[model samples]
Target: MSLMPDRKTIMLVLKDVTQENQYKREKLEQERKFIEQTRMAQMGEMISMIAHQWRQPLSSISATSMNMMIKIQLGEYNLETKEGRDECENSFVGQLEKIEIYTQNLTTTINDFRNFYKPNKLPVLTSLKSVVEKSLKIIEGSLHNDNINIIYDYNFNEKIELYDSELMQVVLNIFKNAQDNFKEKGIEKPLIKITTKERSLIICDNGGGIPEEIMKNIFDPYFSTKDEKNGTGLGLYMSKTIVEDHHKGSLHVDNQEAVEGEGIGACFTIKLNLSSQSMEG
Candidate 1:
């Protein structure tokens, strides 16, 4: 009998990934839509804040201009005598200085808001404290309008690499949430305490804690505690995505009981690696 050469059969299995690819594409599109929607909602809130911020400065400018006009009409300055001319010049300079200061403030406010809305093309090296301060500045007028007290307890100022404006958005979202909660609960003494430690930021509000049942779902997309009119349900979800997914950080929340005479409420903590290596990764 002739020995037959051993033959081996190889089988190949192939999968058509068309459906999977299509699903992924659709998911990305949905996320883009969510981002755009969230941005529109934030734009509305920002416009309101901008109006609040500009109101006083604009009023001051108008008042200053009117005062100067009145002074000119009344012929208050004696321009003939040397001393009178110097005094008149000084008064005009003083009024001009005030107007300049107010104008500068208005310009700064515009720049702040513009930089905030401008998209970041690259990560920036910045201290967490600075980012928090910037975010606070943007929303300061709104906070003042609502009579909300913001307390700062910064224990960290290390520089880290990240998208500052995006982080600002996250900060603003948390502030807005606290503000809304304060209004809804009618907290008499609304307070938000911001504390930074190591590589973490903690924001605590005394606007009553998140309900136990809803706490688990706070980070879920389209989940909201506020009614349809007030809540887009994307703030916390986008915030979580920005910190964790985009920056490789962590965001967590919990209810804190009253302690040391402090009011009880919700607390949000964000942690990011401080090392440059981590950011690069």
Candidate 2:
């Protein structure tokens, strides 16, 4: 008869395995919390952008209403005279049209944020150009406020199967980081350049380059160069996870340099494989 394992040996091995599993569970829980924190921060930033986007339209509507009231008070909007009535009617119609346009813009902003933050049920083939455009819309207000110029060069025409919302989040995060850097450093003529290639995209900022000493640590969790009030340090880490870990793609960064050996800020590159078959919802 073959000898069987002793009770003490079996119990010791089982105990070790149990402890290892418990340790893994704890680590996973911590990571889950970190991801949630970053996501909440992103939502808050998006809301700020929405507020900015709505401000101009709301002001315009208010001004138009005030003007109409002023005209009425001055007895310039008489309904009895055909000329006065026509002028009043035209002014009213113009104001109404302006209000309609503003209302549509507000509605679109809400929908874009909602869709961008909604959890994805599954990965699908998505156009990169569409994703970039949506991400820009989400943060356009913030960029304008910071007086940063954006240049987009879409050189590729293809779709990749992936989580669209996740990708957009990554793109938005990068842009927000660039904007903050420009503000903090007070860079002159701040610019963000986004260029697409056959299967990759590059985002470069003119807010000076990442220091060589800290470049390698940029992707590490909870590692941020910004002051505590402005940064949680999880944005870039989570962005790396979404691009490289979750999507089976690649995300890397480097200091863009000129041929004369001058630093030209940092460039983050993302690459994804083109999907042969598109997935349906």
Q: Pick by lDDT: which candidate is best?
A: 1
Best by TM-score: 1
Supply the global lDDT for candidate 1.
0.88
Candidate 2 local lDDT, 29-142, one digit each (tens): 987887898998777787789988888888888888898788889887778999988999998899889889988988998899989878887887777777899898888987
The local distance difference test score of model 2 is: 0.83
Candidate lDDT (C-alpha), each:
0.88, 0.83
Candidate 1 scores a C-alpha RMSD against the true structure in Å of 3.4
lDDT of 1 at 87: 87
TM-score of candidate 2 against the unseen true structure = 0.87
Residue-wise C-alpha lDDT for candidate 1, range 1-281, written one tens digit per residue = 43555865668999999999999999899988987889898999999999999998889989988998998898888878999889888888998899999999989999999999898888898888889999988999999999988889987756788899999999999999999988988888788899988889899888778888999999999998889988899999999988997788999999996322465799999998646422221
